[model samples]
Target: KKKKKKKTMEMSLNLASSSTSNSVFLFNPILSGKQLAFPCRHQRIPKRVKPFCVKSSINLSGPRQTLSSNWDVSSFSVESLSQSSSRLPSFEELDITNMLLRQRIVFLGSQVDDMTADLVISQLLLLDAEDSERDITLFINSPGGSITAGMGIYDAMKQCKADVSTVCLGLAASMGAFLLASGSKGKRYCMPNSKVMIHQPLGTAGGKAMEMGIRIREMMYHKIKLNKIFSRITGKPESQIEGDTDRDNFLNPWEAKEYGLIDAVIDDGKPGLIAPIGDGSPPPKTKVWDLWKVEGTKKDNKNLPTEQSMIQNGYAAPE
Candidate 1:
């Protein structure tokens, strides 16, 4: 009996040692007593770890949600941009009033096209309506263009209430010379260095021979009319005017004055007096006030001689 009891005790001790060899023990300084632990082949526990948690209001029964009282977003808009741009001035705001006022000078410096002729006519009529008694000056610096256009302007000048004074600044050729010659008798003037040219009217015709012949006839008629006008103005014979205008006849200011195309050659030294030509004799030294001096005396000023007084004084009208 004693031997069997001893054998049972030995077997119990061996089982306890085998279980201890299969188990693991972890030493945790935080724990007061030793805790039993199991060894895991596939899982591990980290030495330091932090807990993750979400906070909430005291009420926990209702659904969790968030609400924002204020929110702002910025973006570009076309209306706002247009309103900002409208504050700037446009191209049409440019002022031309001062320029027009300073230079009462009318410019005929381009080709004598229909548009140019119309503009000149309208401007002259406006000036005439503005002040009929004041002189209107027309400055010509053209190489000449449409004869019909030039004639339109010329006729308007003759009919306008104001006296039209034509001044040639540069080359007054072809139709330009015609207009220059048609200025108010004593008002036609040319700069000393300008050139004047006159030539027969020109035209281009095509189609049937009859059509071309008709055009030729029309051109001849115009030529005849122009000869008459020139003769009347320059006191030259029609034949002479025809011969001179047969081809391009270019003349300097002095020659223009000699040909009666212009009444005077503007002298830089004498502002308003007519400059003399190459002839030995001096030109008539007339003053602007000479024409009005008699009228001025007629007002009983006695400061000058009246036209009647001049007549009584044997001073005949200047030749």
Candidate 2:
């Protein structure tokens, strides 16, 4: 009976030792003061102990067993770095590139405000400083804004060492007209359908009667100065200029040419003396007016009255 009891005790001790070798112990420093144990093999884990199995495989080859966790830190870092490297350049970078390439094409397609004037002046100065002999072209398509801004650009154009050739693409009105007229003689140009408008300086006066009167006198002086400028540019009598500028006067390309406001109207086939900037092709021959013509209408409307219409309409005919 004693031998049989001793043999049973030895078998029980062997089973306990095998279980302890296969089991993994984990210590939860944060959750519990005691150590929790789990089976190391792939088997049905107890429902209460499922959360403790962070890793499915264990390396038992070394004295220190290593758990194969799901976190692959090296691969994650590589993916993050690749994503950052593939991003496109921002708008500021594109703007810088455009500014560098668009040095020769000076676009005045907005209101001639202080900002516009400053930009135009700086571009003109840069162009002149780069190559004084190279002719710089100024494209004016403004409805016209601050007279002060216009004067600033006008003075810069006049003072620049480069010969500025102005082209009117669409509407050149008020101060815009002044800019067009300021271009180098024989180089001033206008698109066939573009319009040019001129008028006296306009403003609103406020404050005391004395202040208002002073402002009026100042305006009159500017008006006279503008009249002289117009007379000089158009080769017209100051009286005629004053009468024409009493209200807004709009002129077609042909009328502008006759009035000495523009040297010539652009012909697509013949760009005349105007030279292209850099490697840019010459302006296309298709005039805006031609695009708007009726499909079957006469190509040349000879019935249209000539400059004689100016005299008949009570305006001085161009000489």
lDDT of each: 0.74, 0.75
Look at candidate 2 and give me any clashing residue pairs: 268-285
Per-residue lDDT over 55-87 for candidate 1, one digit per residue giving the tens place of the 0 to 100 score: 975888865432111211121245544778754
lDDT of 1 at 78: 55
Residue 310 local lDDT, model 1:
89
- The TM-score that candidate 1 achieves is 0.55
What TM-score would candidate 2 get against the native?
Answer: 0.56
lDDT of 2 by residue, 191-229 (tens): 766899999999879999779879989889889988898
Q: In model 1, which range of ten residues has the least summed lDDT?
A: 67-76
lDDT of 1 at 221: 90
lDDT of 1: 0.74
